[model samples]
Each structure stands twice: as C-alpha cells, then as structure tokens.
Target: MAFTFDGPLLLVGAGKMGGALLEGLIAQGLDAGRVRVQDPAPPADIAALLARHGIAAEASVADLTGPPGVIVVAVKPQVMDAVFPPVARLAGARTLVVSIAAGRTLKSFEAHLPAGAAVVRAMPNTPAAIGQGMTVCVPNAHATPAQRQLCEALMSAVGEVAWVEDEASMDAVTAVSGSGPAYVFLLTEALEKAALAAGLDAALARRLARSTVSGAGALLAESALDAAVLRHNVTSPGGTTAAALAVLMADGRFERLLKEAVLAGEGRSRELAK
Candidate 1:
C-alpha cells in the first residue's frame, strides 16, 4: 500500500487502541526505528510487545527529539489535557497530529497547540485490535491534502477508514461504531443466559452463544447483502428462529430499543466533548 509518511512517529499512549495501531503499522512494514512510544505505564503484554520488537518506550517525551512526521494521541480523554501539552511542543511545520481519543474535537487540540497545527480527530471501534475496525476521521482546516492522505494510510493499516467534513457527525460515530461493541457483547451475554434458561448445559450454552454471535458477524462481514436480507433468509415461517424474531421484532421493539441505546451513547459522547 505504498506506505508514505515523512519522518518518524511518536505515539503518546500504549494502551489497547495505541498498542493495536502499533502492531498493525509494524505488520504493514512501518519500520520499528521510525516509531517511538511514550507511555509511563503500559500494560505488561504491551510492554513485552515493545521489547520484543526492540522498540523502547520512554516514560515521558521530555528527552525525545522530534519534528516527527506524525504524532498519534491514543490516550484517554480524561488525561488529554495533562498529557497533550508536552506533545504539542514537539510539533513542527511538518508534523500532523492524529488523535483517537474519544469525545475530543479537533478544536480541542487546536486550542492547545500553536497556530496552524494540522490536527485530525479519529474514532475507531474495539475491532481495531484485529484490523477489522471502522474508523471515521475529521481533519481541521489546517490539515493539508497530503496530511489527510497520510492519515488514511496510517489508519487503514488497522481497519477501513472513512472521512467526514462535518465534525458534528463524530458524536454519532462515537455512538454507533465506537461504543457499539459493548451492545453486541451484551447481546451475546444475554443469549448465553437465555440458553441456560432453555435447559442447555452451562458449557454448551457458553460455546453456542459465543460461536453464534461471532459466526453471524463473520457472515455479515463476508456477505455483500444487507443484514435484513440475511436475517430474513435465516427465518422461515413457523421456524424457531422466526418465532424468536417475532417476539423481538414485535411492534419494532428491538429496533426502537437499539435506537434509544445509541442515542444515549451519543448524548454521553457530546457531554464528554464539552
């Protein structure tokens, strides 16, 4: 994929999302020498991963030299204020900052950095850990076309990437894809309990529920058809699946419930941005 980004990258965090991006970038041929991690306390596994790759993590960016091609802030929104100031000092005319911290707007970074700091705010779901994530990005006015393209190349290494001109849409992106994994997980959790209630053994129930949810996701990913079409194909008249769908779909109950759930998440995302 003609990976192109001038200079090196300085990653500001080494947690789940950060760690996942690091792994993906390396697998896609980004040189280890071109990447540096700054995390005071990364998870044990991630620390080991850095060590194995011979990429040493700095406890702070205090001594790090830069004019890095990119600075990716994959930190928690709660600490961004404290953690980001130091990072902004490293920015040069060529640096592009891409942030995956939820609820942080491009304006938020602009407020802290010097004028003309090219900033992009991106939202990626948990699936990114395995490179199946859906990421949506919004770049500030300062970001150049080349920087935008570079952002796409950097992020697509971890998953599919999309762009939006309206940063307003990011709150919805946070609601739907960003926090949506938990909703799917809750369904699997509920299904496991329901299977047990229906007299299945514990082990079988666990296995069935987990496999069914994952398998259905795999099918959905592979098929070009819409999910509704796939659902209808599985549900025959008078069949068990049809019967269950009837109950869940009655009066559009399930769809309405899911809409409410997503709306709630959207509201919270907005709150965090404030």
Candidate 2:
C-alpha cells in the first residue's frame, strides 16, 4: 500500500538501516521536505541524499520541531534510554512510534512516552541496508489500526513487513529473520572454504559460492514453489545433489544444528532485553 504522511515524519537515526529506509521512502515519493532526520554523524551518502532532496537533518533532536505523525527510532538498543526522552516529547497520543532497535520492547517505549502512546516494536536485519530486509513488528495495546498500518507502511519502505499478534513471538522472530542473514553468509563462507579445499582456485571458489547463493535466492524469490520443492526439483535420486544432501541431512544434523543456533540467538535477545 502507498504511504504518504501529511504531518512531519521524524527519523531518529540515519545509520545504515535508517539511511536505507530514508532512501526507500524518498523513492516511494514521500515528500522530503516533511522529513527530519537526527544523526550526529550520517554517512556521506545519507548526507548527500538529504541535501539533494531538501530534507532537514541535524545532530540533535532539539533541532527538530514536531508533533510528528510518525517517529521512527532506529538507534542502537544500548542507547535507547538516552534517545527516548527527546523522542517522547515529539509524540502526541495519535503519534505512531515505530522502533527498529533490537531487544527493546514496546512496553519499554510506552514507559518513556506519553500515556497511551502508540508504539510498534520491530526487528529488521542488516539486509535492510540494501533494501532486502524482512521486518516483523508487534504493536502495543495502545496502537490503533491506523497506527499499525502506518508502522507497516514505514517499514515496507525498506523491505517486506509482517505483523504479529503475539508479542512473545518476537524473540523467535529475532532469532529467525533478524539474525538469519548471518547464517546465510556463514553458509557461503563454508561453501567457499570447502571448494578451496577441493582444489578449486580461491578466487574462483569465492565467486562461484557468491553467485550460487545469490542466484538461488533470486530463483526462490521468483518461484511460487516451496523451498523444499525447489530442492527436490534440483535433486535427482542418487545424483550428485542428492549425495550432497545425504551428508548435510544425515541423522537430521542440519536441522538440529539450525534449531540450536536459533535458540542461542533467541536466548541472547531475551538477555539483552533485560
């Protein structure tokens, strides 16, 4: 759905993910003049983009004038306490506050903001820097339907967005999509290393691994088939792919390892939330 906010939009950070969302919003025709960004040291690209588009950006939140319709907090989780007070001042009862800060809960935000302020707690991954992000958001009880939609629209600027009715699921969501990219990258690294050990040239192996992963991702995006189906289609019984799968899937090793990894991530997220 198209998203355009008539009132001011305040972005509390202009780092990688924040910059990506800013780029996406402008590309989707959100008026630059109505957007204000707060970042102490924005990357060169973000600074240039804001300047080119006539958007206002400052190092301090005090520079912004707001009762902003939307306030997106993209700061690091560790510094959220410092960030929220200034942000809270900009939030009216109708304001929708969407946060991409990992491990920060909706209730944590509500505690700092005005009574009954609408808030959405979101987890978006590093892939968001390139606009391939997957964001899962959960709204607090105070958030209205329209506020939730606005949060979804704002996040959709960078990549795909999904809403969760149960906030408890957010820990698992963080483990999955929020940390999923690193797992994919680790797989690529392992594949490249194995190829090199098999006598392939280092550069060639790296290139092949990169291409294979990216190409498979593209195919997955364009195909309607489930991933298991796609894997089956590529594997002929007793063939090379099947042989490789046999080792990877032996005694459910692969699935078990992934489950463990996700649990570790989820545990870490919960720990940080405290």
- Top lDDT prediction, candidate number: 1
Worst 10 residues of 1 by lDDT: 59-68
Model 2 Cα shift for residue 226 (angstroms): 1.4
lDDT tens digits, residues 221-258, model 1?
Answer: 99999999999899898999989998999999999999
TM-score, per-candidate, Cα-based = 0.97, 0.95
RMSD to the native, candidate 1? 1.1
Error of 2 at 115 (Å): 0.9
- Prediction-by-prediction clash tally: 0, 0
Model 1: per-residue Cα lDDT at residue 246: 89
